[model samples]
Target: MAFLPTTREEMLQQGYEQVDFVYVSGDAYVDHPSFGCAIITRVLQAYGYSCAILAQPDWHNDDEFTQFGEPRLGFLVSAGNIDSMVNHYSVNKRRRDKDYYSDEGVMGKRPDRPTIVYTQILKRLYPHKPVMIGGIEASLRRLSHYDYWDDKVRRSILMDSQADLLMYGMGENTIVEVADALASGLEAKDICYIRGTVWKTKSIEYVSDYIMLPSYEEVCKDKRTYAKSFHIQHENIDAIAAKVLVEPYDGWYVVQNQPPLPLTQEEMDFTYSLPYERTYHPKYKYIPAIEEVQFSIVSNRGCFGSCAFCAITHHQGRVISTRSKESIVEEAKRITEMPNFKGYIHDVGGPTANFSREACDKQREFGACKSRECLFPKPCNNLIVDHSRYLDILRAVRELPRVKKVFIRSGIRYDYLMYDKNDEFFDELVQHHISGQLKVAPEHISAEVLDKMGKPRKELYLKFVEKFKQKNEQFHKDQYIVPYLMSSHPGCDLNGAIELACYLKKIHHTPKQVQDFYPTPGTPATCMYYTGLDPKTMKPVYVARTHEEKAMQRALMQFTYPQNYDLVYKALKTAGRMDLVGNGPKCLIPYQKPGHFPSRRDQGKRYGQKPYAKKGNERKGMKKR
Candidate 1:
């Protein structure tokens, strides 16, 4: 199986007069199953659709888009695996210097909003061609969303891009349906009844049994309405029982069909079994993104741990799907045979590593509970917290020939692990999977903040930490637990920040980096950030919106650093906790350090310099200025 044709010449050489679908992607062509572009195109190929890759095309001109002339069927567009804006900039909106997905890790290969930009270019170049958008950027923004960069509510990407159809969530199922529909000569707009798709309609007369969200005008005018709209969207994400959602904007309505059903284990296995070249196209000497996932194997998809800040629930759904152990081991064997085989497998995990099964049997039939969470506050009684199957898969992978270490880099939900009564998997994880350190996200220590973030209580995390340490001691391994911390989350006020700092000090752990809360679209936390109201309860919530306040919260997380001295001191003072500014061991900073630079409190004035002293001495030695 050769790599997909990336150029028109290659397509012609492959004996195709015109490809069925010209897939435009923001990433360089990497024919690996881990890349969504590879998965979709390969799936289409398996079904006998001729697809060619048009990756990282020039956004400024239509010439690049028309390189393949026009697809016989339609154009499939995606902003790669990640959202283009996130790929291009940091949380602080600073332009990133490197794009791991691009050829040779170069930056600026694609436009800021590649999905919209590329679709617009296609529409302009071939006015009547069907443009279909999918992937992370389109999936999460399938409805009205708050744009962090723009600091305002923006219409759905489908609306902005004028894409004929928007395939949300995992596109394997949706894309096939779309292709079949288009192949049968049904127009794109008329192919609206398919599951896991969003399409525009001029009239709502045809929409029935669907929940109507607040109009775009209403949501934009009233924060409460926006919160209500988000709550409705969040509740009905299940495939079993979710109703179709309709969001109106001006005269047109964006109708989101029910989510696609969770893929069966056999389907998952077959998807990964596709013939992928498993590396970048030969044109590129290197692609940094492949390095991270080349040795890794994804054994599962979906997550039951619906964290508030995470968009997985909205995008991947909460249903867990796992491939057969045989399928995974087969993949691992192929990985060991690679030319650059290093006798190590990077990871065999997914959205949540230990979530290898559905949360409960009812989830598959009755769907997830609308009002309650599966693992927040505490695990639901119906939660099936088991790790035996996951452990079995890991053991099989470890037993593979030429495999030295199989680390679980994809994070495990510690609270979910704690829910399991069995300790065999936990012990094995400590003894085997961990490299030097195991990372877990105990986002915040404050119970209130954790509740707001939809994370487990602080005590749950503390218990897990204690158990992890005990297992490490029993195994005689000096592995450390690196806790991932977040700052300035919706409910994290100055007090919450101080409490978190105190906890970190008690644990004697200084994180190398701290993540300030970013309110990206399609998350509950983002809703709170935008509306200052918890959609679930409609209660007022505190949000750290100002740059100064967010900075202070971040600095408090790393108060031990000398450079953070001033910010910590100011935060302590502002919070009416100046008591924490003394030289006491309990204090975050010393009163003497008035600024980031050194100073002497005994002087009762500025230290390290005297105004005009150097100039005065120089004047004494020379003529006056």
Candidate 2:
């Protein structure tokens, strides 16, 4: 009904002498289900526990740590919704100008690696109290893994933060189990049997039947050993099929239990139905984080589409956990009642919007296959391709009173949509869901790059595009696909970048923004980025690590931009791809005169548009902007 206590006065106002947990967050408090901090605190409260929020406390002052006094149980720490290093810096390791999660989109509201920093501060102030770290930052770094910002292998966060326990993955189940244990007077060190947690131990006498990973020293000294360790971690991400994994570190051992089971439909519904303020704390001037999610609904959790660049598979697991259609409709009703409601629902999807059900029947009972993926390389033969339920959910929300439209704003798995024999979902998606454009991620057109990225082949994307155009025509609507593209990913060289540029030139669409591969922890692609070897196959992979090469790769994705012409030209020349630099229709750019640069006029000429002609929002095939 109200936001959790954020100060001692608020804590007293709630009539709590001592709270059960003090939730420390790197982000300004936004009590929405979209944020991990809000969900954890709200879940604890729903389970008859009192909790307080310590949002972005100044790390320098000891008074900030003692503001709420001490919790009855312990402290729960998270580095906001994203990793702090990632939130603070771009892929080029440049400091970002803004932090959307902070008030007024300010920067420097929190320190780098705040999960470790905050927990360390908490430990220094309250050394005896347990400090548990979670969120994307802690979850991905729960073991000995590569730290891109540090450019070296770092120990588990539990070891660095000196936190008694670390929770990985979606922590609804894990948090509650740990809370009960703590309230019952069990020490943090004694509570290790719970799933979805990483704990440190000095002896293996109590640990049994666990996979022993290469020692931390070995992985640090050898990239090949690190790749091998990453492969072991990747295979054990499944909940039902994974075994406990132990990594030795000198005199101590870090043990990671198998991931928690995916939430069932009922549990997911209950979690979302918690009493949430659904906005940032009232005292802040403005919180930029609310704009995207205030009117949206999270219809599901978890992703089965295991893209190599994505950390969702490792953090949320490969199992799909979706809410019931009724639950989604209820949330849609809530959105319509908000004062700022514009009769338009911004989103009604999660990790992969169209992944509204389990990939196969055996997954829920037996977990996903350890060695294979559901839709990469090829769709599993046992994969179930149906979207009727998701379509039905969309229809119900669309037909609700005061709701003019409902959009699936999240990433849609085009390959999954194309695989469905029934076109009902696809038809309705084009006709009803799209707000003039639908965003899909093809990532790249190069076969080797796509294979390395664990994405389906370009043929699948081309087919999906053809079908999308047909559906738009059939429905008599103008809709375009906004393909999300990435550059400088491992296994991508100058030739591969040129190949993608040619494909974009052939399609007559240039993305306004292109993501340079960010080597964040826990992703298979990051493993390749750090080790220059594929963990899955142990094959050597090409990595563009230099600033100039990364810039060229990114420029190739936006090759038509006047600003990127020099970089694109350099990339073409470097790749010995001068054949694509001529004044031909297929050439990405015209041959340059010494000191002469192409303008928007030349770009239009290449697209066969008249100079100074107005390029309106034309939904022909897939115009990305």
Candidate 3:
């Protein structure tokens, strides 16, 4: 149970302090104020919508958290960085399974029961109050999904979360739009006609047409692939236009990515013209709306990398867009003026922080192929890569003092960093901007996978790692690389897994943790996971999403004992990775008796397919298996 209560009555009973709409995520070096669920709560309160904002609402207890002060307005959800679609479940389960569907967090072991993160308490206390679900989690779940993590297709999230409605896409604009719509004498059923909304009604249901986006699965493998498929230059309308009927389950149609309307120079300038001190102190709150940790300004939107497993191209499209430096600087000044203001600016970056000017490889007179690598189908010849201007803005930020520190914590593209190795300012960024450790997504190590994903050569990753490792050593502090590794991307199979494990051994360091592949709501990889064939190449690849397969890929990343030993041993045996079994740098796979292994999971259990256990982990003296 959560330390906090899940019920509205429980919340009202307790004399809690003022409810906070936006709070900081408790991760170290992650001080940015979250903009999802909490942000909406703040906005609602300001408009006299009568809601409470609880920062980092305890997931363990929904009752207490929901009960606090004001009358209940529906709950809005967004997990940040990760779209709610994939973040709903544990990493491995959410990403790899095809048959996997999202639920409203776990209710009980009715066996195969569906649940959401905070539905129980909401159901228990506010049964009469409306609870609207939105953000990536609900948006992706609005329709049936082919979860790569589970290896089989699953039902839509709407059917599972049991919330009144769901609003998708970046909800900053949508949440206010939705709240205002609901507050104005509009019925929930009729609200479906609103753009970027999902709701239900009697007799007939309504769902606004989904902007044709690429498959979520493909983005998991490489965002560039998604970009190639749907971006304007490649503009493969047939693939994106191909309809996957929602009749089997009613809600919304499959993703349909429209042409990316690149923000014009004037529009970019206009965004810069908006008030940068983006703070919202609702009427219900006692304090100001701004937070100390996260004073953020989006420098640019969308990506030029067009990785196979990303959705930027499918959603925001390929052409990069930006806000002016003056607007961002002014916002920083406004934040500084707050009574509670501290000389701290957590982050000032966006989707691939390095690319300031839009278009990948922007310098060439003759354009590259016009395929959408980030989407699906294909990338275009007109792809451009431009990052020169972004570097200047970052330097300008460094000179600003009221802003104590500027962070590029939003997952940097090392490929961009490598292009201009001599850019001294970038090296400074590596030293100052990083919060002890820099996180870069070197998604995979295989050449084949890299090419398919439209990523730079694997050699480039090696070169950058070597260069950065040297730089970090020179810096003489704890600053190191927090590499993001993805298992079971579109082109990855046993070979890819083995290769990754071997690379870890060669690097002489083991990853403290890792993430498994998640096909998300709208990406190309989901289709490949479902059909076991990459749409682009029509190549057959074994989708390793079974509990055993997922475990095999995971074991190489850690030294967790017994629970992981069996899986690791099997993975090594299957991959012909016997050398890892003996006492070597990366050897965790030595043969051991079943119960002697060390892992968070029990013996014979694997992630995504852990067998039914009668008791919870907290239960004392209970036998595991």
Candidate 4:
């Protein structure tokens, strides 16, 4: 299949006078299933709607926004695959030097908060046209969210963008429904009842079976109220059990309907089977982001491992959805046929590689337990920990012609793998899938921090490490395990940092880089960071808020660096850990020489010199002595 029309010429060539929908994106046009824009547009095309691409329009002026003209149906806007703020800035709020999604890896292709900016431009250019926003930037910010960059509780994107509608989460079903409704002569405001969407209204009288959340004013003023509102939003994410949620702001209400139902196997297959060019437009020399996923196949979606820092549960839901084996193999065969086909397939996994099925049987019928987690502290007894189907799919793909090796780069939940009674999949994974080092995220070593982060205890990770080593030894392979660690998370202090350092020292592993816990929007960790309390329990939690304190904690994780010597020394001293300030093997840093320089304790005792002596006077006094 040919690439979609990205310009008016192409649109005319496709035998269309006016397109049905013009999809505006923050990232450069890449027709890959991994991209949300591609999937949503293709789904619409499958339903016989003409869609044109407006990838990374120049946001400074209204001219670029009118390139595609007004579409017959509406405008679908997305802030690329990632949030614009995250793409443009680093966790430290520094402007990023490069953007992988842009052509030739250039930065500033799209403005910060592209969804709002683009929609505002569209509304200005064509006042009567309906504008809708989706993708990660809009999905996670669909409701009142804590904006880390702004350092304030901000209203929903719907309020800021003034778009008629906002579709959150995987928007295939929702977008199609929206298009069909609009194509059938329904105004955007009149089509507000679709699931997996957020729409604004002047009143809540029309909303039924809905829960009224704390208003935007309440959430902004009170952290406890925000937590309560977030909790309600969290609980109502499931399609089977969720109810409409209404949040009021300045006499207007933003209503979030229940999430769409999880896609069945056939539905997943159909979506993946859509004709994707599987590469970026030829206009650009290359897109760095496509390199990471061109050879990768996403066999599944959603994650059951609900880590506190992760937003998968909020966006993808907890239920696992898988594509058919035939569909996966066909895609692999197609990959082998590509001109740049190498003997290797980069990855065959999704959010959590091993999660091929729902966490338990009851999850499909009643939705995931709101208060409890599927894999945290310990695996639920009702969890159906199996990977046979996944193993079969991998084996089939590996046997295909021209396929040399298949790797699982997407993270595998080590805790879930450890819970399975059968070790067949584990053995195969170690034997064939691993690429030199298997990376697992054991975020912290302190049990207190782990519990607060909703991660398993340190012992579980250790056991997994032991098992991984044994398996490598059994297979006679010299493979290693790389544990991803984090610092300065809630419930972690100077002592916890010291504890993690000690653990790393015990293992004789010095990580080159440490991840400072970034408190992004719509995650439990972010909530804790902003409120200093766990939303799950509403109990007070310790948070490292100061820059110096956070820096010290991060430096301790990599204490071997020469530049970190002073920070480590100060941190140890401040924590009254003078025992760790010597030249001993266990000491993090060496003590400074006594009387080596002017100090508080050695001010007047240095060679019996006067305290106020100038440099020349000190030298003369030394000569006289």
Best by TM-score: 1
lDDT at residue 506 of model 2 (Cα atoms): 87
What are the per-residue Cα lDDT tens digits for candidate 1 across 32-82? 989999999999999989999999998877788888988989999999989
TM-score of each: 0.95, 0.95, 0.61, 0.95
Tens digits of per-residue lDDT for model 2, 104-181? 999999999999899989998898999998999999999999999889999989999999999999999999999999
- Model 1: runs farther than 4 Å from truth? 594-625
Residue lDDT tens for model 3, 248-289:
234333322222234555554543443222433221122222
Query: Which RMSD does model 1 reach against the true structure?
Result: 4.8
- Please report, as a residue range, the 10-residue window in candidate 3 with the lowest summed lDDT: 22-31
Q: Kindly report which residue stretches of model 4 are placed more than 4 angstroms away from their true locations once superposed.
A: 592-625
Better candidate by TM-score, 1 or 4: 1
Alpha-carbon RMSD, each predicted model: 4.8, 7.5, 12.3, 3.9
Using lDDT as the measure, the top candidate is 2
Candidate 4: residue 102 Cα off by (Å): 0.4
Candidate no. 4 TM-score: 0.95
Alpha carbon deviation, residue 340, candidate 4 (Å): 0.6
Instruction: Give candidate 2's total backbone clashes.
Output: 0
Cα deviation in Å at residue 279, candidate 2?
0.8
